[model samples]
Target: MPDRIRVLHVDDDPAVVEAATSALEQEHCGITVETATNVADGIERLDSEAFDCVVAGYDLPEQTGVEFLDAVRKRSPDLPFILFTSEGNEAAASDAISAGVTDYLRVDGGAEPYARLAHTVVDAVERTVDDIKHVQNTRRERAIEELHSTARAFMRATTEDAVAQITVDTARAILNMPANGVHFADGDSLYPVAWTARVEELLGTPPAFEAGESLAWQAFETGEARVHDDITSIPGRYNPETDIRSEIILPLGDHGVLLIGSCETGAFDDTDVTLARTLSVHATAALNRLDRDRQLREEREFIDQALDTLDDLFYVIDTDGSLRRWNERIPEVTGYSDEEIDEMSVSEFFPGDEHETIGAAIAETQTSGRVTVEAEILTADGERVPYEFAGTRLTDADGTTAGTVGIGRDISQRRAYERQLERKNERLDEFTSIVSHDLRNPLAVAEGNLELARTECDSDALDKVSRAHERMRALIDDLLTFARAGETATDIESVTLADIVEDCWQTVEGPRATLVVEDDRQIRADTAKLRRLLSNLVRNSVEHGSADAQTPSGHTAEHDGESITVRVGIVEDADRHGFYVADDGPGIPEDDREQVFEEGYSTGENGTGFGLKIVQRLAEVHGWTITATESEAGGARFEVTGLEPA
Candidate 1:
């Protein structure tokens, strides 16, 4: 009912033909009849036109209905052939059926039999069409299943040419075409890249479909597939010694086109068109993969060239602390070539004592994402060089650690500069002590004479002179402490904090001061430097707290032991680890906290600011940070952090 079914009726009798035609016309509106009066005419009709059903009379001129059925079977194997006759016999019926006739109808003498013949022809045509469709549908389903089975193989193909040829072969087998070809677009021309079944010989030349010269161009121009039953009928179609009757052109997106041709006229069916289109999709995917792979290869090459131009030693280490790759700077810095480095691990470039430390640092970076540390790496000549190193963790798409990438910056020159600066400061400290010593002796002599003169008579002028001499002595002693601030602790050993604090308390001239050892933590330090730092802090606290503070006579005032209580305790934070010194007294002003460590920054007339400055200098020598803040009782507090504890 979806389309018209063409019926061919061949007979030697005009009356019988007229009856059959009239009956079929009245019975079936979807059927159209083409009449032939003889066997020769029937054969001609079958060859030229596509017919759904063929009905023939048994008594034909020169050929019987059975013979004519055999001729139709040879031309169209699956076309419905029917025999309608008046002289019907069992033997002749068997013959007609054996000749591949779909049905046999007896021409009895009534319109009822004629009507039955018409119905039989229609039924025969519908059944044959359904059978042919079922076969085609089965083929299509099989082809689709085969496509999935081979898809992985096609994707894994390493070469573009291999994939292209595989696509052509797959399309040819699925479509049941005798010839096929795969073409790609190369700038201005579309040329065949792979072909099968003498497709090139059939074209008489390598087919070129460019400049809109052939019907194949329509696929590229419209971005769609096209089918032609007779390719030779199109204008500018190629002629050849061999035959190629039907062809289909499928576009590989904007990349290229695929062509498949057959030798039988109108050989391609609707199923062929669908299969060719599906092949086009797979071909396009292969082409895209190839293009992207080429682009990545070029990008990687560029990155390698860029990294080689850098001066710093840039390298990548595996997750296990093994060297994976490095730049040309590696050989320049380590005196090892790329070939030798390939067999070395990153940990091999460090001393044996530091190998475990650095390895752990790299593992920690992988877990924590980044780490920065200073260490030494060894060169080929067994020389150790200090380097400032930083490592970062690299991850793949799934967010797992792929490796560790790091940069090593040599700091030998920086270390040398620091040593030179330290030598200059030590000399300056010596000159300062000599000058203070020279001035202190003259001031002491002047003070002794003034005191002797004061003993003779209580002169207000003499008292003021005596007080000025005492102040000058205090100034000289503060200058001496500031000059010796450059000296660092030479010998580091495990010393108890409480023991050091008790010893330092005896050295300061603060008899009214109270000491509280709140923490008994053990630390690595120089005993002399720790005593000096603690002594200065205690003196500063007592002088600021007592009513009659420590005088310039190197003695604490008698304040009935009512002085500041200084406490030493551990101070720990998210980023700091060390101790704090706090005092219960009138705290330093908030405005002056920032300048507390600067020389000559006095909070009051009795205060010598060099005490806090000495505290800061010794803390820096030990590589600690000192910060001043308020204590819990609204008193002054100095925190020294970033200490290595035992």
Candidate 2:
């Protein structure tokens, strides 16, 4: 990311070091040179600071150049190491090659050697950056893909039981845990509505437990998640299932409890705990929406009188534009009582010739049954404020206009919002063009160079170049996705996990990776966006899960992540439904877990840090929610919820 290049030149001859350092910096646009007299000082500089490349002489006072290379390799392996020495023979070249030097340059009479070394240093640093980026992008893509698949399953759940079923399936497919129970709460007890073999026998009756009695009851009463590692060790009158050694009870607010149990003790960990909490929260929201819709249906008879509680101005006018009736809200805003408004013509609220416009609006309402206008209205204080008035004409049985009912709202805030949105759209348009053109073009060029570099040399430097290229590409991609996520989704339909996952995985580059499909649930989503989302998630898993797979090109650095296995499936708990993606690799650490989705935060050297941000944005586009935790194989697990049945 830094435009300036910094290289450390170390040698025993002061004159040669000064000449080369000065010549390299003078010739390059953004190169700065620093020097050390011996290898010890160079090693100290590396320890205390950072440099793009290390240029050292083949012969040093204390040791050979190979020894220095070996020592520096221990500290930083991926850093470019170049040998600038007097030895020009094949034996020396072979020794440098065996020592894993990034580049070799023999001392020549002129400035050509230094100039060539400078270019090599730049290319080597660029390659390292690419390698880091490649890994980051790969993992992000996988994580996003899993999130999308889970989202599809969540949206298809309509009923409470369906929600729980999806959650169970998600557990089996993604979490690789098959035992769970979805429960509903009665007045003083909990009843099993949906469940799997994990906790079936414990709650088979109409009511599973009395209020505040069992783990499920306790979760409901406290409105919190409960984890019992060893059920036999707990001294209480509980489910008393001998086969079940561990259980997790997550509260679904007032709805019920989601219970996932295991026959083996200590089968669950922190990731499961966090997952339970997240799914429970989602279940609560789904239940709330359903309850609200049900209540609205039952209370429709009193909707007419509810207008009085609204803040807008409400009034009735005759065909002549005379004010006949108005609500208390009108008086509060206009500084007029009901009696005064009743005595005044609706035209009186408009100053001067505007009354004619009101009269025409009233007449139009009488003819068409409804009319709306944005016009200025004068309050009692004589202040003209912008207002939007919508009116409907009341007609008799004979079809004669008797009066007009109208509502007026102040447009001041609406106007401000409109302007703000307009400006935001303009900025977004400008940004989209820049991302589509500026960064993308250069990225393509870099990618081409990376391929060239790979064919020219067989070293880990190519990995760095590839990673840096991916990081830039991911950033450009995130810009487009971010804008789309905030917009309304017009093309929505049921998307199947089995279908979407295959399509998404095909679009991303997965190295030494396998995708396992556990359940195929249908949920509502924009097909294209869902594919994009899943692609990013899967990429994330593939790259991050294999954190140890990378080998820093020149140094002795070792990474264990080269291949990974990702699982996608549906998850259910008592009264809640969702889906998940799990991997078999090094899981995310607990300390860095909360900030994973944050903008521009990354642990990977080449990461653009926008990958998860894109994932979260796409989720908002579909009105879904997501969370991250550890997977069953000590890898990351991401769950998505807030779904409705397709």
Candidate 3:
């Protein structure tokens, strides 16, 4: 209901007009009275101003109250009109009712009649407002349903042009906006792609908007929708002289802009903008989907080309063991046609004896997500060729194992190389046996003879012979260790660094040297091999760090042997985690550090030179890396890295 009800009162008598105005205004707090002395003045006020209802006396100067009501109805058909008069007659009442009067009442000499008239006027106005609202709501609901149907069509669109055309058509049919168009974004401009027939009829064909050329481009660049109630008021309109007076430019994300225009000023309201924005949203989503689909197609093509170029056989198999996809190499290697390969299962390509193995590998891949196996592939001619196949399980969206994708590589060359290495290792083992047994017996005989001569004559020559024998024995022992260290480590277990360091120190003869273990982190390694590796390093530190120690038969030191301090600590960094052994003795020269690991490389007399090399080999066996540098104490630092934590 209106907060205030405005009423126009018309009567020939000034006294009666004043009395009626006073009565009506006094009847209700919300009623306002405007006075007119005749029908002419009343009609003039009704046309020039807005009033909720009209009140006129039957005895007007120029016309009856029914005639004035007729004039009001001609301008506003639904506006409330009341005929309030002192003259009462059945014929007059009939005329008032036929003229579409909202209420007919007799103006009695009392304030109660005025109150009744005021209440009737309010009721009529509220009824009219309610009827208009019902019609608007019904129309709004229908428009919304139409928009939903149009949105479904948008989703079905397969191309950018289809989406643009649908957007233009929806604006025309649903929004009742006939002068509409859509421009797709291209490089440096928006090209007109779809437009309605009414757009061409009203303003010819819309032009393409270059960068910074039109209000459409402005909306596109800013990513904001604009409603221009009057195109003439806008400064940078594309066609200021065009017949289109109002426009709504909505940006369609990165795709383009949707332009809606009308020939009448203020033709488009808030409802029009809202519906147009909804259409633009649906259109933009469709365009994005098309773009993603196009990209996916291109990516699939690239992958197909890449797979065909593989030298090895590439294949994808379903969980049922049937082949789904394969590269060109698969058919060529198997000597089978493409159609035959596709129809056959993966186990069919292998010999009957290898089917069980291949089936097991496939089952394992499904359970573990990956597997590798070496098997023989039986060709069409019934010849078997060795292959190393690697497979990884493929999963669907729900993470169930859908199939397996993998490659099969020919392993003929690798097999041949392995055989050759096996033969070479046999010969090396034979050579090591000769050095350990055949050479050791003769050297021991010489040592026994030299000892007997020493007791008989006390000669320095006997001592030299004895030292020579010891040097030979040391060489044989080091050679044996170097041979075994090259083999890859398989028996790995976690061992504590501090325990190993202390154990090695106990075995090493370093009475004057002090051992400082800074870290006790556990590391993965073969315990026996680790013990051997640490023993060599600890003995080297003691032998080289002592000041008054004599060089062994063939071992030597760069620094004068003296009382030294050796530290065992953890080495932790971004790329590595391991331990370091550093001493306070004189460090090796930087130029000699690289050569120190080479076999038989030494600087001192009577030095075996295999100690550091054996350290390097042992590290390689465990897949660890060793580097030599100067310690903070100006001593040699050996850091062994790439260790796995226990």
lDDT of 3: 0.85
Tens-digit per-residue lDDT, 1-646, candidate 2: 3588788888888877887787678767687888887878888998777788888888887877778888888877778888888855678778878878898887783668767766777777788778756754554455345545765566556677776676666655555567776778889988777766544554444347787677677668888777888888876647564577887888887888887878777777665565556556656676766677668876853563676688898787776667766666888888877778878877778888587777788778878889998888888999887889999989889977789988999998988888897888888888888889887888888888878877888888788778767777877777687776666566998878889998888866766888998998887888887787788888888777664532112122233556788999987766556678888867666776768889886666767777787788788777888888888777788887766733
Ranking of all candidate structures by their lDDT, best first: 3, 1, 2
Write the residue-wise lDDT of candidate 3 on 179-240 in tens digits.
89999999889999999999889867779989998899999999999999889899888877
Clashing pairs in 1: none
lDDT of 1 by residue, 1-646 (tens): 3378888999978888999998888888887889999999999988889888998999898988999999888989999888998876989999998888899988984768889988898888789888999998998899888877657767898777887888877876765665787777877678878887677657655577775766666677678787889877766664544377787888887778888888777888888788778777888888888888988998988888889887667889987666888888888888888888988888778889888879888888888999987888788998888888889998989998989898888889989988997888878867786767678778879988987897799979997897787777777777776666666667888888898888878877766678899988898877777778888877777766575654223344444446678889888677778888887776666777878788877756656668888889888888888888888866678888879753
The weakest ten consecutive residues by lDDT in model 1 span: 550-559
Index of the highest-lDDT prediction: 3
- Best candidate (score: TM-score): 3
Cα lDDT, model 3, residue 157: 91
> All candidates' TM-scores?
0.60, 0.41, 0.67
